[model samples]
Target chain A: MIEKIDGFAYILGDDINTDDIVPSHTLTMRDVDEMAKCTLEFIDPTFAKNSAQGNIIIAGDNFGTGSSREEAVYVFKVLGIKAIIAKSFARIYFRNLINLGIPGIIVSWNESIFSKGDNLEISLNEGVITNKTKGVKIEFEKLPNFLTKILEEGGILNQLKKTLKG
Target chain B: MGYTIAEKILINHSNLKSISPGQFIDCNIDLIMVHEQLGGRIHKEYEKLEIDYVWDPNKIFFILDHWVPAPTISAAQMHQDCRKFAEKYKFIHNFGYQLDKGICHQVLPEMGFSRPGMLIVGSDSHTTTYGAFNCLATGIGATDVSVVFATGKLWFRVPESFQIIMSGKFNKGVMSKDFILTLIGNISTKGAIYKSLEFHGQGAKNLSIDGRMTISNMVVEAGAKFGIFQPDNKLETWLVNRTKEPYKLVTPDNDANYENTLEYNLSEITPVVAKPSNPGNIAGIEEVEGIEIDQAFLGSCTNGRMEDLRIAAKILKGNNIDPNTRLIIIPASKEIYMEALREGLMEIFLSAGAVVGNCTCGPCIGGHLGVLGSEEVCISSTNRNFKGRMGDPTSEVYLASPAVVAASALKGRIADPREVL
Candidate 1:
């Protein structure tokens, strides 16, 4: 019963690692709201400042690479990021994001298809994103069947909790 | 078919009768370690299962190293959670802020916890450093760590072995860090994914134990499972002096089969540095000479050994640091710190205007101290020089050996160590 998300895109270049996603220094703050304000503070000082809640982010290959830090994923979730579309992802980062219930899609389209401020609509169930402003549509690899359940339950820990409770 | 030391160990400890290269197997774990930074979440996950006791407390070790002497209230809370878990579960191997407590990787081997041919897993990436003792070690995620904690078995694919042979003496100013950086350049970052790297040759034998640790520590940079050199008399002598535990000497058989073989002439390797954004982007020091540096740091599990300090001392003796630069030195372990103090290495560093700190993984992880400012440049002896790795995302980090970093600290620009030494 989840609604589809529509938003302007924030396009980033390649190799966005965990450090840029969430600086280690700000990790001292346990509050999700405070931490999200500083997310991607290193890469774009105005990222949190300029971003509206529930905005979509699209990036080139090898996004969210480096360190298994979970805070990097949590910060994005707290900031209300609708979905992340990347050409590819580092194995660990991809797993981490999926485990945290953050919608991360892997699209094979050329990065040139999307640009900043393009109005994009993402359908989690359909696994397709349409750049409405550019009249472009891109398909992504569907999440594995088991991972869909994890996302539905709001992450691995929550899924585990449900299983234990039952 | 003869077997390499790694193959022999995997077969011996493995539940499977025979595991060929590229085959997956579920193996028994001898030790699983965690630090405070990641332990809280892992412990929370374990609590959800409502397990009464860990699978085996003796096989598990937790140390409060990162953010130890807790840098913040939240870090202190993380430590408190770790303490509660340790106390409740009777985790016998837990070490707090005692004299023996230091970096987990440094202390694990020192306390006779790791033996040759054993499999070790930890929550930190640099756990692969235990491979210096001929152990199969790698890092895992918090969930994987919790799973290993609940069950002393983890699944892994038996990786194909890469035979790397080296010969000839290392050129002056080129240390083990430079040698490893050159190897990573040749292999690229993902070149050795899911493979075992076995170092063998006259060149490897010539390296000191500390230098061997430096090389083995960064195997993760090349995406290798582990890096191991056969244990020899030097290792035997060092281990005997350090611990009373008996360890079996192991080596690869003469006819052992390898998936690939790579040969390097040590004399041909120059001072190498990994450029920003990727550890695989390597270049010679000469290629990037005169690149200004705001800081030069000599520490990390990779280059913070005693031998690394002695070499830096030899180069920095009777010299002052560049007026524009800040150089920080951190010993790898408390034992190395005590030894360096006895040998007056500290005075040599302090007299040269360098700041020497405790034996912790500081600044190397960008958690504390020496965080670079925007547009700042740093030459470091630590592994992994990815962009924003040191502090500022815009700051540039150049990876080099202790010799290169020490020399650059004096010159205020990236310079070859041989020129100053």
Candidate 2:
């Protein structure tokens, strides 16, 4: 659905869990935008104030490795995250990204590929990630056709709506 | 070629008669279990789809375990919303604080909703606890659960499975919790990412259903999609009185494929604890002994069963917790709580300076009850020890079995269970 996502890389370390993304206590908040303010508060207290729209989050292995809370993914959406490129991801977290129409690209484990604030352009169509700042190009696998179809429909809800209407 | 238990269950649940790992298929779910998030988030997502009614009310388990007794006004509103949804749908298995239900994972199995060869999904990650019954179960997000409600089907990628062969027996004061922690320590948190962990062999067979549930519940910490056990006479006997529904049992066929194989001798395992920040950061009891703790929490879906309470009570009997340390005890369900009361375990706990709370997933998730403050350190029987997991980000949590927690509470430090026992 989203052929390309161009943004600056927001770097995080390995094993960034769901708890880091959305703390459990914050889930009680009524406003989504207000809840997003607590994203990664412990890891980077300024993540809420510093992160801007369309920034790509690049992290090491097992990103989003705790809990099945979809609020973790919803926080990224509310913050306008363009895409997440991690060396790996926990299963439920990755699926939530796909269902919410966010591209979660899995790149090989190479922490040296991008630095903080590096301009990166990910072309989902070509399966290539071009670190425009560093002049490096990396190839990754595209999402399966079925999953891409869900993304194209703007999320699982839209896809489900189509199915139900039919 | 023979099929693994996961493959067998998926094949039986889906239109396909056969499936290989990584092949995605639409599977019919036998049950969908949801908790507070159902009212808090899932209802909004489900409303977006504009479906008038859920596919089948009978197939849903509407539970309000987390934030039960509504810790805050916001949580109370969420409970009200869940009540509205349950009332509208008339869910057959609806439960709330009023009904005196505990955690969703424990209640589902105790209610017999978790049966052999069934495929279950829950909004909570520990839903994998049902796999102790030899069923295929995994956690899903709110959006996915909403879609399943609209149409009782969802997509699943057939996961590659690992065969964990457990041999030998446990030493005194050691538990299934210790063995599971050892496995997670050897294989880091993401070792089983997107894979099924099929547990079997002598050590696994020797475990009681409660012990098996404790093991299966936290396999998600290893990033496993499912933690299924092979059906044995223990599970069969346990299910006979719980469920009258005719059910089939599934076993991994001989010569079934596995992504990898791991063998563990449970007898060699000793009391272990996962230190601050991560469940994979395991240390022997002796390694972290005498490390002072501010609190000792003994509850959660992971280790809140009667078996766990009995273990903790045995250690706490005739002994009081340290003056500096606070101990909080919560059973996983009403049944477990009643059983503990009948056994006088509640009396022992109350006399031991432990604040026995109602059955709720309170402090384990840092939702309420025993939330830790900044600079506070706790020894908890719950699964995760992630930073900020139990309240303030600076608060540190150490994960261990209930026995370890009880000993730590008695000493006001991370003490060895062997000493207390």
Candidate 3:
């Protein structure tokens, strides 16, 4: 698992839902790459391209609050979004991110102290996220060992694969 | 302190004799269902696991809903993939569109596959509907579902229980949908995040099975993990005719600890509606009355049942839908459709100028049957009114009960059901 990491940051509003993550209108799609390009297009238009370099995303409460579409996580992973730090998240969306081995950290941050162009560092070991631009440190509940192990093995599938082999 | 209904159910489902909220535990799933759209994602994840076979295929339900009868070529292919997976695994619980089970939420309970004192999960968000039967059902993501398919187990964080001690009697025209709408409006969509709403008191007992299902199914919209009612005679009768398996009913202890309690009186609630773009954007019927509408939909897992159809039919039997507006009625399942047919509800709808469709979650997800165009507006019985929920982003959807949908259809705009009845 990632003990610490730093990446560029992006910000979003409260109640950002799966529909906003990926609209149901065109969800007949299958390819992750194509779908990744279409994500948040209604809101950020260029989010897909900007996310390619593994940018970090910061958002307000209830992120991924609508729908149980796992594609929400798949698209984020494919687009190279490294991690998400939010106030609170819908349970299914948070689980989807963890199951896919992507980081979804719930933490408290002052949006005024940070901007989209800023940088943030997440330390999974210390259970804290530091806004490198403004040097703001926020504490969070570190994930349990079992969940951390799933992320360490690059998702539950890989872990399951190892279990099967053993 | 004693255990709440959710805690009791979780304890029973888990190997543990007792459990507390906030503890993460691995528990076996009593029923795990996948609609075609979610099944597509689950199948992909299952293949990624490289598992040769499902852990327990019989326990899984391969439901051919969401895009029933294949809306397009690609959708047809998705169903085809699910069918092949079910056949290859010899999973006998598969319910194809042709089987007429309707939506999985409606069919699963009607067929007695969803029993009380069990833990159920599904890839679709509305799977919380099974909580109506006193089962601990919740929506799960593709990853969790894939894990369940591989091991028949998934990890869960036990949720705190929030009590709703409901009382009073509803007005004649008021239904359970009205009560839930009023509650959602008061609590906001995310008010009950990650908590289970355990309903009790006279109001909960007065509701029928259908009413209970409507409330539980929409808990996800309120950001609640579960909306449950203690198993009563209404539920007992519903299960007695359907279930062959012996079952046990669990209820909250008298001194059960709850995170919070909110009391509601049935008489205080009015016919309500969730306006365009958000389920939480709610208002009384009078506030939205006379808003122009192009369509009125009466279906989806939330309200697409025989009782829902009967409610709509009763108001429209001697009336006609507005010529400028279109009305579409869908029974939730094949069995529901048959029951409505036997009851002449279908005749009432057809005679009232509404198009009665088969049992499918078509227009609600913007799948098919009656999708809206730009600038169009609809009053629908289904849950959720997010942007482009039924069609173009420019289109608008107002969520209400089946009675509201029927009343609005007759007036070509949003109308209070009480006025019509």
Candidate 4:
């Protein structure tokens, strides 16, 4: 279950790809903990250094596009990013994140209103995001019922295991 | 009722008759290839299905590229998994760090694994590069790959075809990279989603086999199922030199109908780059010149061809890379590496203070080598320059042609290849 979190927002522009989320160089390391130390080193080195665990990421269109590298999704999960709200997502990335049990919401309207460091409250179950600073509230289109069930089960792999075993 | 090169191949191989868009039907896969990274997962997934042997090991090709020579223990584990899988299944083609082992797409055609009128699937997105030979190739998920392993066939929706015809001649310093980027800009990235793109025109004949591969390599970025150019004597000659197997030639019928047709005059094309955040966010090199860059990379299945090396070498022959720049060269395959050595392109790059690395994908994926630091800016030849693409979210990556990357390496800033060439 996703809980409402009041955290600082890191506003990113459109098309934040998987490569930027996780560098390919770190793929050499097997430990997710060690690799997470350098997450977002290209975009903000301090991101890995100073980021509080479970920060919320708000982005524009086409998030997680480019090279279906699963490591890209894995890095964010390891970095403790709570939820990613974007206007839209690349098809494979959306699936991969859901499979990894990451909460990704697609909010089509008022995406530009939220900026960096805004104190935002998100309710995953309600699909509502309220920006207290801007006095704006946005409703995200929830994942389909079937996908919600998969996410609840902790990812597609776990879901698959359960289904196969049952 | 029109058929594209991708559609025709799918129809001929379709288990059912007369398939259309949105209707998925199982069809046999002519080739199932995987690299070190995803191959291990495929094997593990296969184990879950309790499969002793793959449907047709002969048609499956496994390579230890990507993180090969094992950059770390995890990467080594991936290789180990692939090695065991290959041995257990008796897969016909298993390549390590030796000769014939390179980027799957490059070595596949170089060793004649791809042919006209065939359907190929790989775990990597650039698998569409095989479509340059008029084959239908696309990437699939790991579970889907397991399904393909258990059965020789997987299902696909018949994609509509978009015909792109290019005429006129290319301007000086313009390359295939520019032409393809121009199309992405014109059509938008998702403009051709789930469609096969067929390139035809007198100007296409002007491109070499390697150039054609570079153009088709990034078809996935435009959300297309694949991009293909009809085969000609150049492709046939290359295939004949590599394999002795009988090959078939296929093309769209003279009256083949297309859902949409677009024409480009090649002469109007200029050196282009996809600015940070999106591949479709394109601008000509002239528009962004003098933007300082911290890195320059020349490799990837896209621009890592022998001809791409020659272009970069020619530009860097006597010029030194800017002290502020970190330039790295990754040849697509071992064959390209040896050929570059024989052609003295390696010396030119080395003399320019550039680091020449092995045939594996390096900084392109932001893996081991060439990780960009925060606030750094890079000009690279690899497809895709989305935000945080090369390392730091603060660092920026600009995608361009080999010549542009080489020129940028020399100047420590994004540049027009025409200035150096």
Off by over 4 Å in 4: A1-16, A20-63, A70-166, B97-100
- What would the per-residue lDDT of candidate 1 be over residues B124-160, giving only the tens digit for each residue? 7678788788777877667667667767776666778
Query: What TM-score does prediction 1 earn?
Result: 0.85
Task: Tell me how many clashing residue pairs each candidate has.
Answer: 1, 0, 0, 13
Tens-digit lDDT track of model 2 for B7-63: 999999898877899999999999999999887679889988876888999999888
Question: After superposition, which runs of candidate 1 have C-alpha atoms over 4 Å from their true positions?
Answer: A1-12, A45-64, A76-109, A112-166, B1-13, B20-24, B243-259
Off by over 4 Å in 2: A109-111, B97-99
Identify the CAPRI category of the predicted complex in candidate 3.
Answer: medium
TM-scores, all candidates, are 0.85, 0.98, 0.97, 0.81
For residue B109, model 2's alpha carbon misses the true position, in angstroms, by 0.3
Native-to-model Cα distance after best TM-score fit, residue B367 in candidate 1, in Å: 2.7
lDDT of 2 at B180: 90
Best by TM-score: 2
In the range A1-166, model 2's lDDT, one tens digit per residue, is: 4667789989988899999999998888888898999998888888878788327999999999989999999998888888999999999999999999988999974656888898999898888999998899999998899988888887999988888889
lDDT of 4 by residue, B239-270 (tens): 88887877678888777768899998889999
* DockQ of the two-chain complex in candidate 2: 0.86
Tell how far residue A23 is off in model 3, in angstroms: 1.3
Q: What's the residue-level lDDT of B174 in candidate 2?
A: 91
Query: In candidate 2, residue A68 scores what lDDT?
Result: 93
